[model samples]
Target chain A: MGTRNKLIYLLAALGGLLVIRNLYVILLQFPDEAAQGAIYRIMFFHVPCWFICFTAFLAAGVASILYLWKRRMVFDNVAVSAVEIGVVFTATGLVTGSIWARVIWGIWWTWDPRLTWAFITLLVYLGYLMLRRAIDDPTERAKNSAVLCIFAFVSVVITYKAIDWWRTQHPGAVLSFRTGGGNIEPAWEMMLLWNFLALGLIAAAVLLIRLNQEQVRREVDGLRRRVHEL
Target chain B: MRFLRQAGTIAVKDLKAELRTKEAINASLSFALVILLLFSFAFDPTAEQTREISGGLLWLVFAFAGALILNRSFSREQANDCLDILVASPVSGAALFIGKAVANAILILAVEVVCLPVFGVFYNITWTKRPWWLLLVLVLATWGLTVIGTMFSALTVNLRLRELMLPVLVYPMMIPSLMAAMQLTTLLIAGEPVTGEDIVWLRLLIGFDIIFTALGIGLVETVLVN
Candidate 1:
């Protein structure tokens, strides 16, 4: 009945439909790889998860800057929402990747640059959350974490360049926007597209849910304060 | 010009205060010595082994000592509400930040200058043979560390538990500079001739220092305003 609830359901329905379509193409339509075989199938989910992870963190960084500049709580909520979701997607990417590596690279883990960068990024953001929990003052927590997001994101950029700066066996990027999604076969491309659409819808829904939750929690805090005074 | 003069005056003020008390230098040097002693006790690695890891051990000293030193950089201002006095002055936040950063870097550099040869004598590392290259790397890398440490020091000045938060907040940001410095020092310690590889690490160090110094100047005002 409410507008926010309707929006959530609408996004969820759209995501579900797109995901079904993605599975249709993945399991049935797309042809298998001549070299990697069934293991290559995981790339569909792996790439999209990482794509979302990067997008989410970058969004968090921008929101962090805006929060510092504008002194707005909205951006703080946006930042915390984006970073928490980003960490989940990054974990998804890491797990999916490790599985793919187990089947393909003959080991569950490697000190490859991309994997190391992902782990470092995860720790850095995890540190962000830790700092948030450690500080009790709401304003201080928001401001410090905003400055921290900027600092963490810059370090991640340095980590990204580690491949070129040193030697590592981690494969190069998967979705190369420079080459317009490099070398994916037509059917595979279609599956990837639908999967990205599905993940995008899911990200939007999660962000909405988080923002709504924060709003309600703030209201609850305000009501508690009023009750205490009475 | 007036702004820079103010910045210089602040740095001089810190230097004078540090000279009179001699508190920070004593603590930082003692901390560095403890780290050196700890490394030997923990492993007591052979000359060959020490050569391999001396770069890492040296940075551990820098990271920990830098943390100790950075807290003092702002702690002086916290007494008698002197920080409010400075912030309320017409001098820009950038000046306050750079002055503190410079003073912290100089103090830590003095600690490192003494600790470097002490480490050499203790670890039996002959990398001191290339004192020029070693000092270059040390100076650049320590500046990079202090810039971030100094800014974060101001940021955490008002926190209830800053000592706990400072290292957690500062170490990750030090990775690039630390990595590059480690590589360069490793090369020098390995007795490898200076070549294109060392040049790459040097460039990385300079680039990191420049970027962070600019960032500190840009972002420190926000931290100081509160």
Candidate 2:
């Protein structure tokens, strides 16, 4: 097979392995917590979803900043694709966390700082996409949205900090590094590390597909413009 | 110095036009009044009831009215392609943004002059409240609202869904400030006194205003370019 096909196969295989391993680790290997029981299983996927979401948004914000500085479409493409993926990850995190909340906290939703901040952040980016859809010109859309993405990222950071300090309905921080490996158990941390890597790889794989798709779309758009000129 | 002068000039220009047309304030105040009247009827709850929610109700009106003012603030430039001309000029786009934001805040505050006392009477907002503290919160919160609103307004002014997109773009940004404002106002109006918690909320509002104002001046150029 060609190199492109090889890459695709590699990504596909990586994705499959990630799914299988995650299923095995979460379902079979993960011990049922004495306190939370099977419900604690959701923590594996839930935490990773948030990690991916934050990374995706951070990537999008960085790409947006680069797009503004470089004035390149590629950065814009990466930014938009990352934002889309971020939205997906954020949504998954919110929904699954809420489910876990219901199962654990016995409530479907609460004004927990993290949950509220995440929800507000989700709306902010959704607003970004909505603004994107409203504009017709592509460059204007990219430039304006990039500006917005950068600013929105700042807002997100502030929201996270402000809400974290504000009323916190959700649980506290996961990392207590100041205490020297204090929060999660060592084995649990090991499991979390593996899941993070696997999910991160899958995110990268999906991101590659999205970038390629955007490249094709741009090419098609260019070709159409040329044909119309003819 | 030049930037400050340019921003001031733009602010003067907007205020002068507003003085002549009175379109923005007229529309904004009318909207606020109607909303206040409608809410008074809708909630027509007892005195304590009105006193309790008056803070939230007042801010809700201000937020929507602020949106209307923002839309009008930009739409004025949309006339005869004035926005294009202004943007094409060598003056600072950040100045333009700040000028418009300052002008909107002033006009909205003008609307508040008309809206607040009426709301006070209707909702019995006058209690053992500290009016000066309420005014301080109002001014700071409105600054945060206008700066952020002005930025988003610039983003959407040239778009097809300019009006529809304003709230969607700005409301999220406005939440922390607005909530803080509402809480402080609630405390003041409820005769709860300005406690440490309320002071913290005020600090948060001030921080939001300062950070966003800095952000607006920095990013306004990129927004206006394309």
Candidate 3:
């Protein structure tokens, strides 16, 4: 296999192992039996998805800034790809969150601060995609979409802090070493960290694969247009 | 200063053309009146309901009118290729934004002024108390609204779906401003004392204004360069 393909496979295997490890831990040794029980199992998947989404969006913002500064179409492509992946992960997070909420809070949706902010983040990116479709010129589209990505990033900051700014019932800092006080059990903590790393790596791998595919599609379309014109 | 002069020239040009045609103002005013009438008919229009919703209705009229005005504000420039002239000139983007914002603010405020009194008459609401507070909310919120609206309008002016895209893009960003404005307006109309909660919204309004204004100024060049 090519080097990249081999690396992707390795990462995929590692991710699978991490997921299995998390499942094993949850099945064996969760602290709470009554409050968490089977529902606590969802936390491993849901929390990591949200973390990946947040990381992806922050990367998109950085890519947008780089694109605007360097005037590179590659940076724009990367930004757009990152945003698309972020949206997917965000959707996964939202769905998983809703399921967890349904089990825990007895409601499918709550105006909990975190949930509202998450929904707003989704809308902001949705708006970004709409803005892209609305503009036609390739250069204008790149520039405008870059600016919009940056603006949406600003909004995300506001949304993220809205919980802290206005008090709501969403739990704060799920796994903070500084604030959560007592150390988590070493086994659970190790499993959690490994799951996070694995999912983060997988998210990066998916983004890279999608970016390559988009680039190739663009090149092939360009070649076809040229052939037709000739 | 020179940029401001050029901006003023552009603003005056727009105002004069608008005054001469009177098309946009008439269309917007008539539209606002129709909306007010529709709301009055649709709602119970009893004293209680009217008092509760009048501020909201007035702001709603302003928002719709502002959208219409934004959609049309660039028409004169587009029709006569004035944007190219402005771009070629030495006018700063901030100045251009401010000038356009000024014109939009005036047009929307005019519509609001005309509509508010008519609304008061229709709803039997008193405006004599807390006029300053009401004006303060209107000015701050509308400034924020028009600044963002004008920037987006300029950004989308060259798009194929300019008409549809403007509001779609503008409304989402305007949410915080709209919420704050509506809350403040509701408070004023109800004659509630301005408390810490109201100040929070006021601060939000100010924050939105500063951030968006800076964003518009910084990004306008990028928008117009292409």
Say which candidate scores most in TM-score. 2
Off by over 4 Å in 3: A31-37, A111-114, A177-194, B41-43, B47-57
Q: Is candidate 1 or candidate 2 better by TM-score?
A: 2
Spell out the clash pairs found in candidate 3: none
Model 2 alpha-carbon miss at residue B104, Å: 0.6
- What is candidate 2's lDDT per residue for A100-156, written digit by digit as tens? 999888998987657777888999999988988898777999999998898788656
Root-mean-square deviation per candidate: 2.4, 2.0, 2.8
Candidate 2 local accuracy as lDDT? 0.83
Tens-digit lDDT track of model 1 for B1-226: 9878989999999988998998888988998998888888788556577888778888889888878888888878988999999999998999989888888899989998888889888887776667788788889999999998898788778777778877777787777788788878877777775686568778889998998998889888887777
Residue pairs with backbone overlap in model 1:
none
Q: Rank by DockQ, descending?
A: 2, 3, 1
- What C-alpha lDDT values do all the predictions have? 0.83, 0.83, 0.79
Error of 1 at B70 (Å): 1.4
Which window of 10 residues has the lowest lDDT sum in candidate 2 chain B?
A: B120-129
What clash count does candidate 2 reach?
Answer: 0
lDDT of 1 by residue, A13-114 (tens): 899889887888788877778999888989899888877887889999999999999989889899989999989998999999899999899999997756
- Candidate 3 CAPRI-style tier: medium
